[model samples]
Target: MANLYAGIEGGGTHSILVLLNQSGEIVYKGEGPGLNKWLIGLEECVSRIGKMIRRAIDGIHMKSGIPLKSVGLALAGSEHEKSKRELKELMMDKFDWIESVESCTDAQCALSMISKSGAGMLLISGTGSCCQIINPDGVSRQCGGWGNILGDEGSAYWISFKAIKTILNHEDGLETSLHDISYIKEAIHKYFEVEDNTGFMEIFYAKSDARKVAGFCVEVAKGATKVKDGLCLHLFCEAGRYLAKHITAQLSSIDEKILSAPEGLQIVCVGSVFKSWELLQKGFMQVLQEYKSKKNLKNISLLRLNQSVAVGAAFHGARSVDQILPLEYSKNATVFSQIEL
Candidate 1:
């Protein structure tokens, strides 16, 4: 039987599992719910992930007639040391083809894929936002990534909050450009089951966390796009700009030597915020253009990965078994076909 490699990518919304062969061809793929231990109960999350892993292995055996030998997982909630230990334990209890199990936070995998040299910056804005910078000397510094509450400035929730605030201001006669699409208003009202501003306020009054309130952004963005609200458009742009600004601040924190260092610096952007919001993407580029021109630094280049973090996770997993896996494995790997599920 041919040897098989296993890779798993876990995110807030979903999980992807892939099986690849020595030839860098994917033999199987499996998917399941998001595996963030915080979002989903840890026990439930691990159970779901285990099921997906089992399915992936079985699929690979069925398709390629190979026995699985190694598995690597890139987990969404694996940032904390405690969480990583727990995730590793959860995986250890599962299927036996796993000779060695390797795991890493999803962000690291994303950064690795963007910068094969491991020296670059990646801004990931999905349900949350974070900026990662890797210097030529292999020194790394992180900025933002405060999650939905203290940070996540350029996230969908942030934009949605702005849009809602603008709508409310218009209604209160505080602004003139107040635009409304019944679709959005209605959806928000239905989702919250609130009749008017008064009711919405009641819900706001009930829940104090900004993250909880920001949950309304994606649905609203989808609804408002149909109605063509100028205000909604502005909100997207603002969110994007906000994300870019955060990146700028992070970049500024880097040592001047790191900035001007001969080694190449790579910036990677991940997360849903960048992927889902058009405004955020535009704003990020605008901010980058301005920052680069102002700094006169030519060593940094931003990379936008076409593949989702899951692909990176899978690659991370594959590399764990053999850290020396040629860099081309990721580029030529058959993982993409298995990822679609």
Candidate 2:
């Protein structure tokens, strides 16, 4: 029987479900709502995830007669042990045939997407930002990810937060722009179709919503990057530094005696924040280089692109179904195909 594997990359905003075959090719893909149990409650989260998984399974079963053998999920709210256990138990109740079911945080999933050694750092800067370090002994530590209220310094929300403040300051005759981005204000106005202060208020004051404001980072990034806004560039640079600080913090916590990094640590990044942007990545890399040089450490290297996070989950699931392996081990990116979103 040609069994299948399922990977569900669940986040605060959206969830992606992917099915992989024996050769690790994507067979079916589907999407569902987020699995943040804290926000949506445990029952709803599990229900939505179960629905999406079944949909993907049904799609593949009809076309290829593949029975789903295992499922590996990386969910947003599963970072805590209690949440992880809750999600795992709920999922197990629904899916019993899945012999090797495993669940963990989404960052851990992103980590699985890259390295097979299971001992590397993963920096995820999407709507939120966090740096995770996993040593050889399977100990994991995190930096940032304090959510929108307290932390997440080098994330999309942070970038958008600073960009909006600059805009409002400029409107108030504060001239907070870093460079000649006058054209950007016009572009932003056109994009959002805001003609007056009232329009601006409506955009920002639409219930004082953080996500509504943070969502504008995409537009702000385009405009600022196009016009070469110095302030925007500065923000990304700062973001890189802040992210490096977190990475370095994790590095300091690790006992150098056990970890054998003959060369240096390889940091893998995944998320919407780092996808296809020259200025941000450039800024990020530059800061990292400077930081490592000054610290006189082994010097960390970056993989930059972190594709196939969901596919990584699928690979682990498939592996679990096939053999008795370590519950927490990394898988290589080369073993999986591109996870088409």
Candidate 3:
């Protein structure tokens, strides 16, 4: 029987599972529902994960009873110590065929995607937004992981919400310094399938759906990129500035040397929002440039992972079991943008 490893990236919106052979080749892939314990109960989350794993194994015709060497899970809302321990124990108990189980936060798994030395920063701006930094000595600091109500800041939901609010303000005759908001207004109405503000309210406020709200960001991106709407363009640039703040908030805590190092600070930018880099670059670079100059930093590099973060979870699983994967971490990421002070 061949040694096999499993990695799962469990997010609030969706989850991905991958199976890798001993040589670091991915053999099977599967997807399941969101496994955030805060959004879905722990039992339901674990149950969905278990079913996904079983389906993957069946897909590969692995009925020979050869146990998986280890399973790595990077789950959202599993950052707490108690949640991590419970999830690990539950997975082990549910699958006697698994030899070991390691669970960690999804952000940590993302960090592993590029930083083999476990020293770097990860900025996430998906359905939610947050920044996490780990020093060379393994100390970790975080900023802006709050849910939508508190402070998603540069998230898709935030951008969408801002667009809607701007429309509402214009309708109420409160916003006077507006350029052309017709594109944003039309896009919002079409996206929500509503002709009026009342209809939009029912879907957004009455239903209390954050995911649906966040989905509108795609339309905003289209407004900026395809239609060239001024309002939409400004919204994206604003989101970029907010995201840059997530990085700057951690600067004081990180070692000054790391910030000024010749290699430059590597910041891993994750999430769908980053896909609109061209639209976001203006405000993003503006904020970063000002910060770098003031702090006297040498340079900063932003990168995006080339593969699914599940691969990193697999690497973590391999490491937890005292096994080394043949994969090269350097080739896993591509630099998106670099700014010099």
Error of 2 at 290 (Å): 5.1
In model 2, what is the error at residue 315, expressed in angstroms? 3.9
- Candidate 3: segments with Cα more than 4 A from true spot: 64-66, 173-177
**What are the lDDT figures for the candidates, one per model?**
0.62, 0.65, 0.84
Return the top candidate by TM-score: 3
Candidate 3 per-residue lDDT over residues 1-341, each given as its tens digit: 47888899876778889998888889998888878788778889889987888898899988735688888888877877899899888888887888888886556677777666667888988888889888888788889877788898989989999999898888889885366778888888888899798897687667877778999999999989987989999999999999999988998888766676676988888889999989888998888887875665678888999877788788788888898777777888899888776
Quote each prediction's TM-score: 0.75, 0.78, 0.92
- What is the C-alpha lDDT profile of model 1 across 173-227, one tens digit per residue? 8885545544556666776677787876765566543445566776656654665
Q: Top model by lDDT, which number? A: 3
| TM-score of candidate 2 versus the correct structure, residues matched by position | 0.78
Q: Arrange candidates by lDDT, highest first: which order?
A: 3, 2, 1
Total colliding residue pairs, candidate 2: 0
What candidate 1 gets wrong by more than 4 Å, as runs, is 61-67, 94-97, 165-184, 190-227, 253-265, 275-278, 285-294, 298-302, 329-341
